[model samples]
Target: MTEGTDRPRIIEYAGNGFVITWEPARCRHAAECVRGLPTVFDNTRRPWIVTDGATVDEVVTVVDRCPSYALGYRTADGRWRSAPAGA
Candidate 1:
């Protein structure tokens, strides 16, 4: 765990083809991610945001919906991938 008042703590989860980055301090708990992808973003579960619970595309889609910008992702090669329109 990380602690700081000046910098947000970041947690990373790696999946088969992508990595998800989360910033808890930046999260507003808006539920956009939960609404978009329940299986992967379940707040009720420990270590929420199961990177492998869904496909890379699906994860990307939900992460993009995070209103607080707390969620983000990059491909295995370190290229950022944005969600498709309407995702």
Candidate 2:
């Protein structure tokens, strides 16, 4: 959680081969993640982001399409691909 927000600024969902991080405040509702991989990014689900729903490669590909960079991933090897400056 950030300074004044009740919710976390970044939420993490981990799986076997990778870990996914989501920044709700940074999301622009473009739906690229949901459209690209519904099984993994289904907002209807309790946790919403389920990394086990898809493979590591699939998750990475879809997350990269995020226009606002609200979605990011960290590989098992500890490589992080997060948001850009000001995003």
Top model by lDDT, which number? 2
**What TM-score should be assigned to candidate 1?**
0.78
* lDDT string, candidate 2, 1-87, tens digits: 558655448988988889999998889988999999998888888888877758888988899999988899999876778977654
Cα displacement (angstroms), candidate 1, residue 56, comes to 1.1
lDDT of 2: 0.86
Q: After superposition on all CA atoms, how large is the RMSD of candidate 1?
A: 6.4
lDDT to native, each model: 0.79, 0.86
**Which digits, one per residue and each the tens of the lDDT, describe model 1 over residues 1-87?**
877676557788888899888888778999998898888788989988787668888887778778767788898665674334443
Candidate 1 segments exceeding 4 Å error: 1-5, 81-87
Displacement of residue 44 (Cα, Å) in model 2 is 2.0
Clash statistics: count for each candidate: 0, 0
